[model samples]
Target: MALDGQNVCRHHGGNAPQSLRAGERRVTEERARVLVETYGRKIETTAAEALLDEVQWTAGHVAWLRERVQEIESEAAVAATDREHPLVWGVTREKSGGEDRGTTEEAAPNVWLKLYQQERTHLVKVCSEAIRAGIEERRIKLAEQQGVLVAQAIRAILGDLDLTVEQQARVPEVVPRHLRALAS
Candidate 1:
């Protein structure tokens, strides 16, 4: 395979890419060991790193999406507020004055529903990518667990590892706390 802009021992079927620096090797080994401990079973270094990368990337994307959704909701709420125009038409105002607050409250559910749909759509996109990458059914199932709740989805993904207490304590420092909580 290619590594650092050069091909490694491709003819010899060398699995280790030639580009790994000393520090990266240490980090990779630590991550691989953590994966094995987390799953209570042996896992190849490459595969472990790949799984960790996937989980991290998915979590990051979901977090970004959630933040964006919140921003969108804020915008929506502000937009839902009734603004007065100099040229008033058939608009009616209650004797109490001010726009109808109930209209804004009624829209809150729809805003939540729209955000939920966006999250679900993003999850399906991730799942499809996993399928295309030829991930196993177990991994696919884990990927699909990503839903509206970011922490809960991460917890569900790590739950599949079934890490023992000792192993859980040995989880890699690189792993986020939300994911580590699953093992706990």
Candidate 2:
């Protein structure tokens, strides 16, 4: 579940080419708006607005995660270079219970690695949940809108005739084959 650089790259669509400048590769506001509009057409305005809001929050969260990951890695690198014991082994000095201080240099690399991986896993889970919630919200909103549209369309199609309210309500349930074909 732990996310590595590969996972980050995958979620981002792919790793940016090394030669591409950050400014060159960044998505412009206009481009983002066009993309939202393109996808927005499939759903109602409420859903689109919700998606846009979720996207903004997700962007900020992702930025923070990236920064935190960088900080952790940088700290590890500095510790490895500056201390006699590498970060993989253990901390240079560890505080124990009852105000006792101890050097945990005997710790295995896997222990530190597991802690690092756990952090990444937690981040990945947070990211996944945020995205999943957004998708679910959009899906529910779109389905609700579609249901309303269908009802309105059916009412309009049956409205011109001299049918009672009861008959109009039953129109969808007993729609004629010809009418269904025409609608389709």
- TM-scores for every predicted model: 0.25, 0.26
Candidate 2 structure quality by residue, lDDT tens digits, 16-109 = 5542333234545556778888866554566545555556655665566666556756876776754433434555467776656776565444
What's model 1's lDDT at 65? Answer: 64
Error of 1 at 67 (Å): 1.3
* RMSD of each candidate relative to the true structure: 22.8, 17.9
Model 1 lDDT tens row, 37-61: 8877844677545655565666676
Clashing residue pairs in candidate 2, if any? Answer: none
Give residue 68's lDDT in candidate 2 (0 to 100).
58
lDDT of 2: 0.59
